[model samples]
Target: MFRFLITLTGLLGALGVGVAAWSSHGLPAFVPAEQLPLALERARAASLHHMLHTLALLGVALWCRQRPGLWLNLAGTLFTLGILGFAGGIYLLRIIAGINEGPLIYVVPLGGFCLMFGWLALIVAGWQDSGAPQKHD
Candidate 1:
């Protein structure tokens, strides 16, 4: 279960990174002033990518056959909220506001920071599991 969750998260993260990279291929030609639409598109793509991570986090919490401990629970909470509040807020702002300045705009980056914390929590979970001594009867 542990391996599966970790591998799944890694794979999903890699896929998100890959799609972000691919989507960015044509971005260089645009001048800075004209990049608003492009940035919006990227943010939209990132939202979708973040959703994948969000789903993986849920799966890690719910689908794992073993019971989850504190770290997993915290990570899951952070990841879910971060994706929704951070990336979701940004996606909404871009779609609705048509630009960046607004109350909701700050939510986007805060979500990102939450996501970082979530990932860190996940690492800590793995580390804790690894540090536990194996027992045998």
Candidate 2:
């Protein structure tokens, strides 16, 4: 699971860079001149969020490698969920105009909540480890 999370970080990081490049260079060709600014702005926002969360997820994964606890797992899960749902949804909305998404749109904030809880859970896990035996392996 830890290894998977690390691999996921690489994937997300690469994707974020690719998206950023597209936003910087490729978007102007596809989107209309009038809407170019809007498209670039949204794409930049999504890319920034995606990259930031990728780093956060990477940190959780690395921490999990040593601690291997519930909170670590939860943090990694929530970060992934938040990245996919929150930033991912924002990116999609710009592309797909009128798709019937229904309650799926709510995933953004729900995912954000999950991320916040995940970090809080990590803090709890750290507290649980206070005065405990330390093992790097």
Candidate 3:
């Protein structure tokens, strides 16, 4: 699980950078001129969240290596889910027209909530690990 999380973090980080580049260079070609600004804004926002949460996942992965607790695992899982739902949903909404009012609209906020809860889980992990003995190499 630790190795998987680390690999996933690296993959997500690369994907986030690629998405940011595409948003800046390629998005304008796809969106109409009138709608380009809003589309770009949304894309950039998604990329930002994508990159930030990927970093958070990296932290959780490293923490798991040291402690390997339930809360850390939950944090990593929630961070991954949040990135997918929040960032991936925004990218989908921007690229696919006429889906604004669909059920996908709920995904972004749900993802945001997942991110918030992931942080809370991290706090719990730290609290639980505080009294535990440290493992040394």
Candidate that would win on TM-score: 3
Structure candidate 3, residue pairs in collision: none
* Model 1 agreement with the true structure over 12-96: per-residue lDDT tens digits: 5665565455435533443264765766575656657485665758565553335556787678767767766665565456544
Clashes of 1: 0
TM-score of 3: 0.92
- lDDT of candidate 3 over 1-137, digit per residue (tens): 78989999999999999889988999878888988888988987898899999999999988887778889989999999999888988887646453678677888888888999999999999888965545623
State TM-scores per candidate.
Answer: 0.59, 0.80, 0.92
Ranking by TM-score: 3, 2, 1
Computed on alpha carbons, the lDDT of every model, listed in order, comes to 0.63, 0.75, 0.86
How much is 136 displaced in model 1, in angstroms? Answer: 21
Task: Give the per-residue lDDT of model 2 (tens digit) for 36-78.
Answer: 7777777777777788889988988887777677777788888
Record all residue pairs in model 2 with backbone atoms less than 3 Å apart, i.e. clashing.
none
Candidate 2's TM-score: 0.80
**Per-residue error at 104 for model 3, in Å?**
1.8
